[model samples]
Target: MSSQRYELVFSEGPGTGEDTVVVAPTGLAGPGGHPVYEDATGIVRAEISDRGEVRVLATGGGQNAVRVVRVRPLP
Candidate 1:
C-alpha cells in the first residue's frame, strides 16, 4: 500500500471528463501485474500498465465508450 495518490481522468470524447482518485498499489492487479483501480461509485474500473496504457475493464451500466485519458500524480 503505497501512500502515493493519482488522478484518473475519464472521458467520452475529445475533452476532459470525470475524474477519480486512486491510490498506488491498489488491492487489485491486472494482466502483466499492472495496477487496477475503480471509481468510488464502482461504476468504472481501469487497469493501467507500466507503459501508461489504460484498459477499461468494466463500465457498470452505461454502454458509452468511456476511457481513461489521463493519469496524474497527486500530492
Candidate 2:
C-alpha cells in the first residue's frame, strides 16, 4: 500500500473564523457521495450539501460509523 498526504481545514464558524486548521491525512481522500469517518471530536467528515449547508459527521476515529453536522453562513 502507498501513503498519501491531505490537509483538512476548518474554515469558518461561530468562533472558528480566522481559524484555518490543517490536518495531514494518513488515508485516502474521501470521494463524494461516500460516507465519512468520524473523529473523537464528534466530527467524522464534513461535506457541503446541495443546499449549501456544510454537513459534519461524527466518528470516534475507530468505528465505521459517522455523525453529521450542518453549517451555513448567515446573511
Candidate 3:
C-alpha cells in the first residue's frame, strides 16, 4: 500500500489566527496532480493551489479550537 502525507491548518481559539495539522492520505491524487479529498470533519476546510500551496479555513468561536486539512501529491 502506498501511503501519502497531507498538511492541515485551521484557526483555533481567540486570536489564535491560523493553526496547522498534518494528515496521511489513504489514496493518491485523482488527477492533474491535485489533492484528493474524500471526507472532511469539524469546522475544518481545505484549499489547494496548483503552485503547490495548501490553505485551510477554520474559525473558533472565541474559545480556542483549531483544525485544518491539506492534501498534496508525493514523488
Candidate 4:
C-alpha cells in the first residue's frame, strides 16, 4: 500500500443541493478511476479524482451532521 498526504473536503447543501470535494496529494489512481477512501473494516467511500468531480455510490448518513473524517496517511 502507498501513502501520501490528502485533503478530505465536504460541502453542505445550499438552498438547493449538497456536494463534496476530495483532493489527493500524490494524484494516486484508485479504484473505479477515482480515488477511494477505505476504512479499517474494509468499508470504502467514494472519492474524487485529480479533477474536480463528485460521485455518490452509498447512501450517505443524511443531512444531519455529515462526518468528514480525515486520516493521516501512513508514510
Residue pairs in candidate 1 whose N, alpha carbon or C atoms collide under 3 angstroms: none
Task: Report the poorest 10 consecutive residues by lDDT, candidate 2.
Answer: 1-10
What C-alpha lDDT, on a 0 to 100 scale, does residue 20 get in candidate 2?
A: 28
Per-candidate alpha-carbon RMSD to the true structure: 3.5, 9.8, 7.6, 7.9
Off by over 4 Å in 2: 1-17, 21-44, 61-75
TM-score winner between candidates 1 and 2: 1
- Among these predictions, the greatest TM-score belongs to 1
The whole-model lDDT of each prediction reads 0.65, 0.35, 0.44, 0.42
Clashing pairs in 2: 38-44, 38-59, 39-59, 44-57, 56-68, 56-69, 57-67, 58-67
lDDT of 2 by residue, 1-75 (tens): 111211234544455544322222223334455223333343445444334343454445565432222332322
For all predicted structures, in order, the TM-scores are 0.61, 0.27, 0.32, 0.31
- How do the residues 1-75 of candidate 4 rate in per-residue lDDT, one tens digit apiece? 234433344445445444433333324344567665533333334454445343433535553554443333344
By lDDT, the best candidate is 1
Q: Name the regions of candidate 4 deviating beyond 4 angstroms.
A: 1-3, 15-32, 39-44, 59-75
Give lDDT for model 3: 0.44
Better of 1 and 4 by TM-score: 1
How many angstroms is residue 49 displaced in model 3 relative to the true structure, after the best TM-score fit? Answer: 4.7
